[model samples]
Target: MKLKPTIFVFAIWATGLCHAYASTSHEIECPTEISAAALAINAPEGWSAYAQEGLRLRSAEPALGPPEEKAFLKPGSTKSIKGGSIDSWLELSGSGPTGKWIVCRYGERGEITLSKKLHDNTSACTVSSRREQVQVSCTW
Candidate 1:
């Protein structure tokens, strides 16, 4: 997806073109915390799993198969979402049925830490930067 550098000009243009323009790099919120914990626990035991896809779908990163077999977009999300990258670490976050998610990648170690809210109904985890099913704010 080709990202539009200017965020104010548009919110949700083409589904694939828009990623995360605003995500919390500071202290996280409740939704973010829960998701992070669940993702850590859900990690498969005795297997070294890393986020192969930075801007695409991390869940389907390991699937090196045909398009029909691969799920590039997470459930409840129409398109793949991505946050900006800092150095080698790519930060990603979104809120929907997935609640809030975060993925941090380390360059040298090839480490990718994934997190997502397992169950959330009380808090929306959104801000003023959202428009219904369109763009939801990922910032704190």
Candidate 2:
């Protein structure tokens, strides 16, 4: 019984240590530029523009969490993400016509792009355009 308590304490300590390591200054070589556009440009038929109040792009990799920079997309406008760095995933969230939704996409590191498509049960986010830097356009 005493041994069990000791083991449990060790486990907690180990978990904390892992979290600490994840937040340390670990350099991850990745693209430093990003851009996000919120519009109905390439949205599917019947789909319309909706405000993405909580649009954000951030690192999905645990080790890159702290160094994980984020870019926010305006609620109902199109603009470039000036200073943000992300690795692994891009998150898009907000209330749409149907309801509230949050979407995640695995990023393409080599190509410096997000996965081709983003969708929920009733709506989808498509890549409207891509240019000099990593540009993303979504409609829902």
Candidate 3:
């Protein structure tokens, strides 16, 4: 199989549903905590893994013997991958206000780190938090 460079676009909508766009790609939804494992096991054969921070997929069988180069994910940005086009998105939320971040990347043997920090806001009577680093990895 041949790999095409494609962009994965994710947008947060008002209803809390994530909107995603990619060229000739299919969408897969996984549980918030197990997204990394799900993507790895569910990826089609002959397609490698690609993910952003906090997300990851296992390596896929390459059409050729080995892959040319590895890919990495950028925080608050998108990355493209080779081989089969399998794209996915995950969301998590509780009762109060919510925020969402999306990252996209492609290639093999790639990794990223994700973290979170929480802050209390007395003025707004709300608790604010930010994800520090989210890790993602892929190999072929």
RMSD values, in order shown: 17.8, 15.4, 22.6
Question: Scored by CA lDDT, what does every candidate get?
Answer: 0.29, 0.34, 0.26
Where model 3 places Cα greater than 4 Å from the true spot, the runs are: 1-82, 90-98, 105-107, 113-140
Sort the predicted structures by TM-score, highest score first: 1, 2, 3
- How do all models score by TM-score? 0.20, 0.20, 0.16
Query: Where is the poorest 10-residue window by lDDT in model 3?
Result: 120-129
lDDT score, residue 69, model 2?
35
User: Per-residue alpha-carbon lDDT of model 3 for 1-140, expressed as tens digits?
Assistant: 65443422222242244223211222222113425444444558998676443344232211111122222221222334343233222112222232121222222343432222112111111111123222322111
Clashing pairs in 2: none
Residue 121, model 1, lDDT: 21
Where's the lowest-lDDT run of ten residues in candidate 1?
56-65
Instruction: Give every collision pair in model 1.
Output: 35-116, 35-117
Number of the predicted model whose lDDT against the real structure is largest: 2
Identify the superior model by TM-score, candidate 1 or candidate 3.
1
lDDT of 1: 0.29
